[model samples]
Target: MTVVQVSAGWVPLAAALLLTVATAAAALDGVLAARAGGRPLGEGLLTPAAETARLFRQRRRTTVAADLPLQRIGGAGLLTAALLMVTVVPFGRWTVADLSVGVVWFNAMDVLLWAALWLAGWGPNSVHPLVAGHRFLAQALSYELPLMFALTTPAVAAGSLRLGDLVAAQSGLWFVVWMPVAFVVFCAGVLAFSAWGPFSAALGGGATGGVLAESAGVDRWLVTAGRYALLTAGAAFGATAFLGGGHGPLLPAWLWVLVKTALLLAVLVALRRRLPVVRPERLTVPAWLVVLPLVLVQLLVVSVVVVVRG
Candidate 1:
């Protein structure tokens, strides 16, 4: 690669590192905010931390009906999957491991969702946890297909799976301008994967926070940390794919990444308050049969535009 390409490559990795630090800060900030309000530090460790403390304080209830091993495996699996997804993400121009099949790698990593959620549900051997896990499984089936199809919209436009190439292609205009529908679809997928609002069926109120309901202490912390990391990854992907990556006229590449990522994260966090959770069953039918198909059509439209322009 040329010097510019090499320099560009570091953008994503740098963005990823910055995101890690920012998330740590945010988690810490959440803790501080809670403490200032007269809550325990552990309670303030962000929502995940508080949940962890709750789990740790509770009695370690065991039943002959539970698959203990599976529960442990599931929790660990979620963390692993999140980590794996981060590997292929381009922060700005740099990626830790950029491959021509970067997009495929992302899709492949998502397979861990099934194993992780199943383990969480089955291992707990409780009705609430099990029900939550099954709910997640059903929700996953609904959203994953559409998410993949949405991702393909950008790949089709760029004509490459390499995220770096995708970013580079946006020298003048970002993909979001041409593929607004796909961009919306991609955001929706991210929200669903993160179990964010409107798609948080796996984390419904009654089930003790769903799959992670029974987890305690460090286990809960890890799950929560992994989630922030996942969100950062998703934001980075969106920025890289659609928001011009690290390209900005006056600012440094890293700054551009930070700006874009923060914006995306803000939007995501804000949506928490704006959107209501949808039932898993409603999502399954409408998201797939209707929403996903529309995304595919959007992809086709984008492709036509690209072809015409070419």
Candidate 2:
């Protein structure tokens, strides 16, 4: 399948699409929370818009010795990371960059997210936020290797790093069907990087809102939006890498891509605040003891199957 790359000038379309999906995720999360509390669904739907307006009207709050420039960069860089992640991701038959090394590109973006998040924490120069930043790095160290192996599984099976080829390789069977472990790990990686759900220790699970401890006003909004954007990007990429990107009956390919991405994004959002927060300290233990070994075994299984088929 030939994926047409849109001109660089139309990159805003990608950004628009990401924002749209991110907004939907936010709305879904709000609605779920409302339902959980037995509140009206209409009020839940208005949550995102209301929060945005409230934050917009609020004044900026500054720390005693905050690194203002770095703080601002970190806040903005987070949303930027999500934008870059989607550049290589195709919406059905069209993509922005179409890089042959799309898989590695996502890997690099995840690393960039580490830097952005750390900066967000460090720039505040506050104790809890600083601690939160370090906690995320600690949490990242545990999941990253297994995450890498999970990512490698599909590329190994498809025998190419190109996402289009990976998608095409799933014509007969979605990778998620045969590579369930990888798909699970991949979703875990998404939540971890987004600082969401059970993986949100860095966002103030056991501590004082960790990275969010010192944020205020517009700055706070940016960081919050960034997390949603990252989750949205992950869903889009995961749909491509695992769920057989855009391959479905009846609906147009692009619509199928949107539908799959939304479904995955919805699952991730509904799970927020519902699961126990994995303490940053204890997170490393199970991540290493159980998750890592399972993904490694999954990788080995994939390698054997690929070799046998060859």
The most accurate candidate by lDDT is: 2
Model 1 weakest lDDT span, ten residues long: 1-10
lDDT, model 2, position 207? 59
lDDT of all the models against the reference? 0.71, 0.90
Q: Candidate 2 has what TM-score? A: 0.98
Q: Give the per-residue lDDT of model 1 (tens digit) for 72-184.
A: 77766665666677666565545567778888887777667776777777787877778888888888888888889888888888889987778778878888998888888
Q: Summarize candidate 2's per-residue lDDT along 172-251 as a digit string, tens digits.
A: 99999999999999999999999999999988766577898988889999998899999999999999999999898989
Q: Which candidate number has the best TM-score?
A: 2
lDDT of candidate model 1 versus the reference = 0.71
